[model samples]
Target chain A: MKDNVKLMKGNEAIAMAAIRYGCDGYFGYPITPQSEVLETLEAQMPWETTGMVVLQAESEVASINMVYGGAATGKAVMTSSSSPGVSLMQEGISYLAASELPALIVNVMRGGPGLGTIHPSQSDYFQATKGGGHGDYHLIVLAPSTVQEMADFVSLGFDLAFKYRTPSMILADGVVGQMMEKVVLPEQRPRRTEEEIRRQCPWAVTGKDHGRTKRNIVTSLELDSAVMEKNNERFQRTYREIEKNEVRYEARYTEDADYLVVAFGSIARICMKAIEDARKEGVKVGLIRPITLWPFPYDAIREAAKNVKGILCVEINAGQMIEDVRLAVSDSVPVRHFGRMGGIVPNPNEILDALRRDFIDKPANAKED
Target chain B: MTREEIIRPENKVYSRPRLIDDNYMHYCPGCSHGVVHKLVAEVIEEMGLEEKAIGIAPVGCSVFAYNYIDCDWIEAAHGRAPALATAASRLNPDKVVFTYQGDGDLAAIGSAETIHACTRGENIVIIMINNGIYGMTGGQMSPCTILGAKTATSPYGRRSDLNGFPLKVSNVVALLDGTCYVTRQAVHTVQAVRKAKNALKKAFKNAIEKKGTSFVEVVGTCSSGWKLTPEKSNKWMEENMFVNYPLGDIKDTAAGLEEKTVEVKKS
Candidate 1:
């Protein structure tokens, strides 16, 4: 068997992985649950001795715009905050997307309608997957369940962001952000050469040099309606391609199962444990965990629908993911939802009981296999 | 004509353009922005910091100052030049970074950013032009406008009961410990222009030495707002404005012990 990794908190793993991965800048304002990230960077940055810029801005707006400036220079920059801070950053995030700048933002969600308590909650699922800012754009949202995944996703998120020339987000709740678990970091890589960055992002603000072209203008102001429409259409094409190419999901024991569980992030972790317990009790249950929440794992959900008798959507929010599950399963299978709200995390045993009562205890009314 | 009576070649030596080019400036005629830009460019060249210096331009009239100055320039959003300059200086500590901002952009919209950046003691320079009115917006009253000065918004003259008094930005910024240099100067005559240029150069040099944030506010003339010729506007600034906003160093580390008493309180 493979050896388990050393234990670390999710936020600590993110900060370490970001440092090791050659991130040049970390700009953020402190908010609950995500403060560990800045604290860790502050302690570790002096020792690294690299050209790392870590600044605690006055507000979330300033932090995000700082990331904007760093990203405009083709640097690997990131920021993290809770819900209210993230809300303040919507304008800058929209501008970054419009400029097609590569950046990373981590959202450690808390309960909220306005100035909500700083506790673990998945209420931001819709805000993350949907376009959080004005205009037609999307951020590649990665939902991580484990501390190991948290570390791995930081590097992966940067890679995807640079590849797509779009911002990427690691959407995690307070539990995933604060929980401790074993994580193994990836090997470090050299910084990208100036020539390579120029080739990759020719529009970066590198200043005008001799014999070079005039400085490029990075703005989202297109006064002409036709030109604006064309830009929007171009973004749509890119989004469609991303949907086809980057959809990631995991399926466990879906073959000839009577019930399938659909979930993501921390809620998915609990659902997995519930599936294992139900299996021990001879309940034919499986799991479908979506890794990419934006280009959601719709294809996997559709494929699992062929054999499972029913689908149970589990989440920390009330009936949020259920809509997506229904969209994938259509009317072919019966889909039920079990969730908790306002920083309350659903227990694995409770999920297992919901699965048994919904699938194993009920007689087949609309079975597929 | 005799050789002495003819215009000698040596007379053209000092008359040659120090900074401003022969091209027609895009600014409205009599705009003090042209004079201020020339002073900054001359200072940069005099200090031999052209190659290693980066300037940030604000969204007001000075947004296009980069076109006139031959150096690395980054155009920032409205009132965000200071924040941009802060990040740029942090990223390249060895390079000299400065921002050119107007009264509306600096004192009105970006007051928070300006205050925070100064408080952080960022190793950068901020050159603010206080013209008492928004020159770019066709003469709207600004935060630095004099009390009872009439403008587009304050058609009945600014009142103490309604619009409050003029804000002294240099005095406000001088209260931050992070700032190593703070001065309020005016450019109403040739001599005042030279003095203002020297003050700006000193601020830039201080920032380059990694001393701390250095700020210089130049009390400029808005001929268009005052409905006067450029020469008359300069006289108006010298006769009226300089009294309300004096031309001198408000805070500087090298000045003396008395000046250091006004050092900004560190958070």
Candidate 2:
């Protein structure tokens, strides 16, 4: 109660935080698991108080396009969806990326590969990090594990989005979305002033009209291969800058642990509990929870890997983030993947058992030896 | 400033709009895009909307339309211009927002977006360039491609059973209660160009007045896509396209053409 703290679901926190952080507009469609986001926003009716416009768009395609439109005007706009709905929004996401517009997209992930289940799953980890649509583009991805982070990351994502003039995605799974916890929502931030927007986002098409300044044309269409290549190169440089400056993660017990566990999102929270459980059994286990999936905290993982015997990559999907961990460790230490696929969330005991099997059962070659 | 002193026989009958950029258009000679661009620029310039007009360019042949229209422009993905225009207009109520799209972009791939934008009564102008076939994609059969029309994809000609009926999207949009005006026009002749410009002017004005969605379908000619000369293409459109999509205003809520006022119900 110190800072407007209240019990809330992660999804509801996202909705509340979006409104509190001066989000100009929200466009979304109803989908399993994540439907509470739309419902909460509608129930709150922030338009009456904050002048924040919310529209339940006809489809995911329309909703994301609306974000693309609103972003073109330098407005803090966003859309939320689950796995299948996120799939529908890929084209608009690609367009937003190409146009170099800033937007916040929340994917409260559900089981995938074709509406597999209504329960939580991390199946979209690959789709979110890789270029989901047809283009050479990437979204600034944030993985929020707790209801508090769900509330906190909205502003962080928007700031990073506007900073790079790129779309940002808050990738939270179904468990994180549906689970309730105490969250102290951020203080209300006023919407950007017109003068602030004009100064901050010169490329935004505010219709300051003709001859006022150089016309702002927001488009990714470059017919000339040479020009397109230059644009792509510029984006790559920005990504490299983000990698250098914005790789975020939380490392625990990594200094003295013999085995490191790399995980993200809700699974990371589970892994932290598993690390504690392993510690009770006299197992020196540590966790490297990556908060930013894209521009992933590879350096941190590599740093942690240096002290551990081997790394176990834990996930809710069949080894999606493991690939990134492998790239980070680079065969210097053995990185094994353990995951539960298709909506079944593995418990902390199961994760500790996995560590027991990988380390205790086999006194195998510790990479250091 | 007497007429006798100011008026001279050598005075130009027409001058290019200031908004029309100096860069050459990539469209084929005699393409309807050139005239359409001229008219749009003129409307924005004449109304002094030069400072307040925002345009959306849909993916297709006119994807580069922003290059010619010197204003704040947004290039949307294929078939998503209406959605983009809706956001732009909704957020900037005082600004004139419009989308320039082709038959394939609006009636084919973007039909849902186009229909929904109109149904929501989004205050935006939609200038649809309908040449019946997909022009930029090497003349593929579009949703509005005429029955028995020959295209690259329809070598033997478009069969009714195979391709289905041609869509009159403007007519369908006119039926929506949210739409303020729906008109079909052409620009092959001098008089036709004048009428087409008039239709565009009205559409842009409707957006500024928040009179709901205004759609103007330009019955255009794709000379290269139709495999005909510039003159023959216009003739073909006159004989074929005009019959399916007739010219003139089909609905005009702004002018009180209908007895029913604003029907708030969305389709």
Top of the candidates by lDDT: 2
Q: Which ten residues in a row have the lowest lDDT in candidate 1 chain A?
A: A208-217
- TM-score, prediction 1: 0.85
Error of 2 at A325 (Å): 1.0
Can you list the residue pairs that collide in candidate 1?
A: B175-B264
Q: Candidate 2 DockQ score?
A: 0.67
User: Candidate 1's error at B218, in angstroms?
Assistant: 2.5
lDDT of 1 by residue, B12-91 (tens): 54653344445556787777788888888888779977655678778777777866776667666677777777776776
- What TM-score would you report for chain A in candidate 2? 0.97
Using TM-score, give the best candidate's number.
2
| Model 1 TM-score on chain A | 0.94
- Compute the lDDT of residue A305 as modeled in candidate 2: 90
Q: What local lDDT does model 2 show for residue B51?
A: 80
